[model samples]
Target: MRLSAEHAHLIRAQALELAGAQARVRLYGSRLHDHLRGGDVDLLLELPSLPANPALLAAQLAGRVSRALHGRKVDVLIDAPGLKQLPIHQIARSQGVLL
Candidate 1:
């Protein structure tokens, strides 16, 4: 996916803030394009371990990201080693481009 300067910057900043030093964040899908319809930002975040409160983290990240990006929708995908059983999880493991 090709990312514009603004979107790329926002994604990188948010990814780093949300993952800190442990996780890697990857942006995927149509939102990566320039003339796109503000589709939900597809993110794949790979973390070393799940947090104590996953829901809270998701909500907090969503809120912060939404506010940062204004009208754009943000979809965050938090990944971890534990999800190896799932097929889609392979994206998080292999295709992720660290933020």
Candidate 2:
């Protein structure tokens, strides 16, 4: 579906807010394009500091965003520093667009 400007605005605002607490939140995939559809809100979230419960933090952030914006679909990917060695993930880490 064509995401309305209002929806985009809400996404941007929530993303910025989430990014403040995490390492970095990048908006990726078709949602970033001005004209695109049938794609989820792709988010590459990086957490610099390794908290006691990393998954918990990620889940909380995702839950807050999902709850705050009812009916909005989002897919959050949390990338912790010094973990995972996939090339695509690494590329996303280096070349991804930061929100």
Candidate 3:
């Protein structure tokens, strides 16, 4: 993963803070490849239960994480018990590095 230890910790911390301790975080996309440069952070947050407002939660998590990362672009995808699993979610889970 391209993220520094501090960044990874921040992301995991923020995700858990908003989504609960049971949530799982993964890092995906170009940043996963060390050879790649200047890619935005791609994160998949897997939740144990569905949130009342998934979209709002996603936005809040993304905004908080992005600010924590010094304004770096952060893309957050959410996976919950009842939410539809998109292809991107599959790709992320398959290729993502757990953080």
Best by lDDT: 3
Error of 1 at 40 (Å): 1.4
Q: For residue 10, what is the lDDT in candidate 1?
A: 73
Best by TM-score: 3
**Looking at candidate 3, what is the lDDT of residue 88?**
100
TM-score of 2: 0.63
Q: By descending TM-score, how would the candidates be arranged? A: 3, 1, 2
lDDT tens digits, residues 1-99, model 2?
Answer: 245566555655665575555466766667656666566566677777555665665676667666756745667776775655466566666655675
Ranked by lDDT, top first: 3, 1, 2
TM-score of each prediction: 0.70, 0.63, 0.96
- CA error at residue 60 for candidate 1, angstroms: 1.8
Clashes of each: 0, 0, 0
lDDT of 1 by residue, 1-99 (tens): 555667667766766676677656777666556677657766776678876665566666767777877856777666765543465567544654554
> CA shift at 14, candidate 1, in angstroms?
2.7
